[model samples]
Target: RGMNAYERLTSYWPSYDSISPEARRAYLQWLSSGRKAPHANIGYVFLFFYGLERRVFVDAKTDQAAAGDIPIIIAEVERLLSIYGKNNSFNNYASRFVDFLRQGQILARRYQKAPPAPLPYGYEMPVELRIGLGQLAADKQPMPADWALAWVLSDHNVGKRTPVTRCKEAFAQLFCMRYEERYGAGMVLPQNKTRLRLQYNTASAGLPPQELDGLSGIPDVTATSAARKKLQQLVDECTVQLEPYSRYLGRNPDTPDALEGLLQLPVNLWPPTARTALAELKQRIGDGMVVMSFGELAGRLQSAGSLSREKVLTLARALESLHIGIEPDVLTGSRTPKSEDNVALFATQADDGDLRSSPAYSAASVTLDLACAVAAADGDTSPQEIMLLSQHIDSWSHLSGAHRKRLKAHLRLQLNQPPTLQSLKMKLEPLAEPAKRVVAAFLAHLAQVDGEVSPAEVKLLERVYKTLQLDPQSLYSDLHVASSGSSVGSSQTTPSIPGASPSKPVGGFALDQERIAQLQRETEQVSALLAQVFVDDKPAEPDDVVVEETVEDTSSICGLDADHSAFLRVLVSRTEWSHDELEAVASDMELMLDGALEQINDMAFEHFDMPVTEGEDPFEVNPDIMDKLPL
Candidate 1:
């Protein structure tokens, strides 16, 4: 029977491991002479050979032994293909050879394990082959010197070993070929040991090494050790140069553990050009060209506002290293300053006389002063009071943790020397108009923090209102207090100035002399009645006659005469009396008077020849009221 395709292929190509050396040599000779074979069968032979070569190349210990043989195989294949002309058979073999070389170059780079021996002598290489090997070595995947030497020795009947000097020369030639391929062809190889050492050291460092023109002789053991030490010294110098930058950046360079932690951080955590910029900044600061503290510099960086205690301590160390003076109380080595000294320092810093020029600073200072004053207004500072004050400050300002801590310290110091009302007012006077309003509202809020505004707190708030030059009614309105009268048990009120009107006109009506006197009497009566109401749990109801008299008195005080007063009295008598019954009756009477006033206004407008719309009735005509009129 005829052989099948698999059998035919296997017959022509025995397993590579099973092939005898003589048979392989004879086959290569015939292939080089252009003897045609089945293209598929020849391809299978080349593939099997490449697989065997791959195994030998990948084994580190034996790879150097086989490296010398690769070039011979490549050269023989090239000779065969040149004679055979272009065809699938030659193409397949050529492709496999190229693939093998590529993989070997990659393995050389990945391992970076060059053999101790160099290339052997007396093997002439084609310019194309030299250029290919040069390109591979220059691609950062250095071709192993011993590997190239072995390849050069492949076709020759040389001994197992070669002279190291001759090998070095061959390796140098290969490297030069690569260098010429990369740069232009006319450049000479660099022969200076100093330049080579520089390139080597620079490559060992983080930066890309400049290409050296030529290889100097390899150094002996003592020379190599010395070179390594010099390289390490350069590295140390670089680290020392970075010390100022890290210190000014709030990183502790002295602490090895801290530096190691910094190294492990992500790239973006340390911004680009930050070290250089900070170094320049430090130089500027040292020269007195820029005046700023380390803390202020760190405050401008990202994630610096929320620094941890450890980081804060590290920042202190860094600042010390830079010789940038920090306030003794602001930060010291790992621990916070002593409480008393810290408080004193904070108070002094915050209360500097120059704060008057800065509205925000003055406002903060006055706020702390007022808080201390209010806290002690009722004789002592309670924990609840301190807590309430803290919350108020937090809500009012966007203060960092360090600033807040300093403020707390200042507050404690202020409690020792609470300012008088006049002093506090003077301090607060520099605040802007909007800030003054905020302070007024804050004081009012603070007064009611204990769930009830105390008499002392009310008195303090009143003083503040006047001191701040704010309207008392507006202050009370902001506090949501009842505007009709002062709060119970408190003496706060809109006090009348000496030359000012005794009574502010209500509803745009001027009070005559009698009406003014009557209004004063009624105000006193209301105050007395309110005091009574608060004293008794349930106030006793006044008799009808007394209620009628009170209603008539209030009406006349409000500028209404006898007829209108009688109408109000009738309205009050019809409603059941309560503690605030007088107030309710007064409200109703005011509404009725408003309508009557409107009718009078319309009639006056008509008299003045102003047209009035037909459907618009300014007043409701009450027949019962009209009939009761004296006219």
Candidate 2:
């Protein structure tokens, strides 16, 4: 029993003095094996955790190991949690330990010191993640995916008492889509070199002896007085933007006005000198400046004659930090190619942009939507392919830069959002004749770009063909009549799809002269129409409405049985409850505590589409059903 680790454990807390002698031997044996067991006694793990906590908050900080040892500490903590995380006591402490590490990173940033490390995506809760990623202040417009991601990761009630978490996989899909689109093309990326910080108060704090409970390796409440989250005014202002995306913590979300609510604006913390710029930017945003082309942005910033180029860029960054995205791409130039215009610099500010107001733009935007549908038709194309598809959209420079912005946004939304027949129906039904032919030919071209037409592509194309009244049978021979009619190199839009590197028909169709001519002609017609019809011919009544459907709460909520349902209602009312309180309630309802809990959680996974309710002793409800409750 007198071993190295047992002695270390006692140094963390005197409570370890009562650990059983048998447990003591197990703990030492576990430590001697490098503490690498996949499973171990919860008590033994806690004893080890006591030492880890000391290393992080006490030893690491006090000994200046916070410089580099924190990463090793985090890795060890994560490894321990991977094994014992199911234990409520262990999971809660470990999860909070990681979160507090994140807090330290944020605090370190504020103190102008280096953060130990960046928290990787999915490493912590969504609330903390959003703040860390600078999403909180990002006056991000509520795109359908954003709303859907928020709704699905949240909790909701199916019936009177049946509460469940919404789909997490859906949230992950949307998150990855957004991340790749913003950061680069891929499922995940390494952390950016942005600064991070966190602080702790030690002067006014009193230290606990080893006899006291094992300290949680967190800073004192005084240091965290503002709760780590209260940084950046704009972040606090647009609370609806990112805060609700908190990762499911087995607890239900706090209730607000489930049925209704009001938005509270963040205070303007910008210094007085740039007040003119802020006012100008606000005015432009209010006046439908949704797609602030680099050209337009330079002119507007220059209107502030007092502000130099550096001052203008600083002002833009300041606005972006507040979540008001404006001209992020254009740095020093007033003139940029139409290709550069597609950046939705003001996407965080405006909901319905004037870009869609133009009949020509709206008519053209639908083309990109269907293109994305075609690209994803097989449901196996990589995001990079879809992005390459955006480059194809980019070649349609005939459409103004503003139009491209809206078009690309549509493509991104379609790629991640749940597909809807109604949106396609609405868009296709209203198209004029020229628009219809161009739309049909565009899909035909995109579908066969891989040389061999996929069944999924053919199937999606058939639907599109029928919708536009293009003859599905004539899909092959109409355009490719003669070899001279090939249009492969005739226009910029014919740039080969990523997989189809060559300009001509690729696979089996590559050698067939008739098929090659057809692909060329198909490319020509599609490009010509895109250049002419998309900009020249405007529909009499263009459907300028953005294609997004409001998903009903009923669609997402998973229902539980009468007993479990009733139990859920009780659980959602409060975040934390003692085991005795939970048991007393279960007994009053004539239900077995363990079975009802398990059954309800099963429904949480099955219907709510997430695994909730991890640990107990102090249950923190995070389901969205609690969203209806006043916070």
Candidate 3:
């Protein structure tokens, strides 16, 4: 009578009777104390967890009333793990027990007809795994980095699906990235398997193995208000542009020649003359090149009657950018086409000068002209300069072959008889404001391409600047860009270019050239910033810049509006920031983080010669930049 059935089990060597009287009393005290948390012994924690496993598995299996306790059991397990999870074995068993309650409980023999508790509280399926199990891409989670994490979670054989067999993890990431691009994120595939094979150390509980449903819906990432606003703007813009052509979209946006595809569908909306030219070009595209000679192209263009040079160039260039070759020299006896010849799209008369109607082409063509002029300033144009000119012409896809040929001829003419620099005011008149800065910036960069701006090249740059109505000092900044490797700043405020500057005054003990002094100032500013970050000492400010953080209005700093100004303030305070840290702050500030860094640096270029922030991942403030208010 002294020992009941429970007492008999407790008296077993591995049970409560195995512990000392003092230890047994401590365990009983903990049990009576409501099992709150911060338990003392791992054995005591496991001893208690064993009973929970039995109640959930054994009792719930045969009794419907017992099955109702599954959720409560899961929550209790979650709570205990929160406290004593430091024990590795206990952590593993407790976590698996909870996983069973949430997903595997449905597999029990008694619960097979219907799971009393389906997906217990606080449990979620991973999006990638759900997708692998056959979730629709449109319905599945939006994972920008799905490839990085998805395939590993899938736990399936994909050897037959891909050519890659090794480094599966890396290949999975690459495959998934491409998968997202082609099919759009995730394709809702049919569940690869309806049943999951969950393996864990549940045998100790004396419970039989059971099957559970593996299919689970993934929770989608909620779109932030800012994201929704951008989506709305894009939808509105697309609606305006596509509404008229929606009916003509015989296929998806994957169609390269949408216009030709539409025109083939028996449409009569196009003008007869426009249709004829389009048909001929389409045939030329099928033939792999535009076979007409320069004179023939001119004849065809003139036959258009009222078509302007701007319209002719724009239409022809747009067609060529699509990889449709317009080889005006194919029939010419030379056989080989001139590479990057800025030839006209439709033929032009000799009197019809350089095509300037297209603003984009005007800016690019002028930049090339100024580049050649600057290269020849020293009266010795090397192959490198000429090569650079040709490379640019090849990359300018928006210019027609005829127009590009013209540009190429201009380069040749310069090499044979170097053209002298002249006022570019009239050439720049039709160009946009941003294009104007490009004209002067390109000249400075070209002069500094050889690593040093010569006196002759410097004078030519100055003249180009005056002609473009830009500041002459910016010439040095542009040269500095080539010397330092920074990008061109915006038109609003001329920051400078990137690249190597001429070697500094070597000794640097006394006053030197203004450019050398500028370099010294930048070096000193970098030192001041280092002192602030590492030594926590305030560096003496330049006399020209005196900032009072407390007195300043955050809404506007260095001509930036409220949003950007605040973003810059955070960057100014820290020297280095991780990509994630910057993204978090940008998201919190409601600013698009993708190009936010560039925009801030572009504006910073105006005030300082250096970029405020640079680098993509581990984005950091330029250590060499001035330690002033970089607004």
Q: What's the TM-score of every candidate structure?
A: 0.25, 0.27, 0.28
Q: Report the lDDT tens digits of candidate 2 across residue range 1-631.
A: 3444333333222345676665577687888888866655565776777676667667765677564687787788888777767665456556556555544433311212211232222212222333322222122222233322332232121111111223233223434454345434211211222211221211111233221122223221111112121211222232223233222211334422111100111113222433466566666665233554445554443332233344444444455554454432223232122423433444343433323334445444555566667767787765445645666556555566655654565565456542454466754665566666655655665555544456776677667777677666544432231222443222232222222323443342234445444544444455444444345434342222322322333312255543455456555434455687667656655578788788867776665565445578876555433322211
What is the overall TM-score of model 2 with all chains considered together? 0.27
- Clash counts per candidate, in order, are 5, 29, 33
In candidate 2, which residue ranges exceed 4 Å CA deviation? 1-357, 382-384, 400-403, 418-422, 432-435, 478-631
Candidates 1 and 3 compared: the better one by TM-score is 3
Assess candidate 2 and give its lDDT. 0.44
Compose the digit string of candidate 3's lDDT tens values, residues 1-631: 1211122123211355466665566666567776754745555666678777777767887998888988888888888888777655556457656765555422212211221221212222222233233223223434333432333222111111211221233233344544455447433322221122333334243444443344343211111223223323332343333332332232344542333323322222334664576567565546322233434544443332233333333334444433333322221111222322323233333333433224344444445556777888777876656765676566455566555655565455546545455544554555454555654554564566454566777777788777767778877767766455444442333344333465535553222234333432332322232222223212232231222222233235577765566566555434466787667666655678877677878777887767887787888667445334522
Residue-level lDDT of model 1, residues 1-631, one tens digit each, is 2222122233333554555554455455434544445432453345334453453344423767566666666665555455432444334334334333433422222223433221221122221233333333334344343334333333111112111122233223433344335433322211212111111111011223232232223211111122223323332333333333333333443442233333322222334444444455456555222323334455333332344444444444443344433333234221343323222222222223222112233235456677677667877776666665565444333344344444554565566557677876644555555556655655554444444455666667777777888766555554553222233223344532212223335564332434323323322332232233223223232221211111112213124453343333232212122324323333433434445344533543454333112212222223223212211
Kindly report which residue stretches of model 1 are placed more than 4 angstroms away from their true locations once superposed: 1-339, 343-365, 393-427, 432-438, 452-631
Question: C-alpha displacement of 10 in model 1, angstroms?
Answer: 90
For model 3, the superposed segments whose C-alpha errors exceed 4 Å read 1-14, 34-36, 104-151, 154-176, 181-200, 203-631
For residue 516, give model 1's deviation from the true position in Å: 39
**Candidate numbers sorted by TM-score from highest down:** 3, 2, 1
Instruction: Report how far off residue 20 is in candidate 1 (Å).
Output: 81
Q: How much is the lDDT of residue 348 in candidate 2?
A: 46
Worst-scoring 10-residue span by lDDT in model 3: 154-163
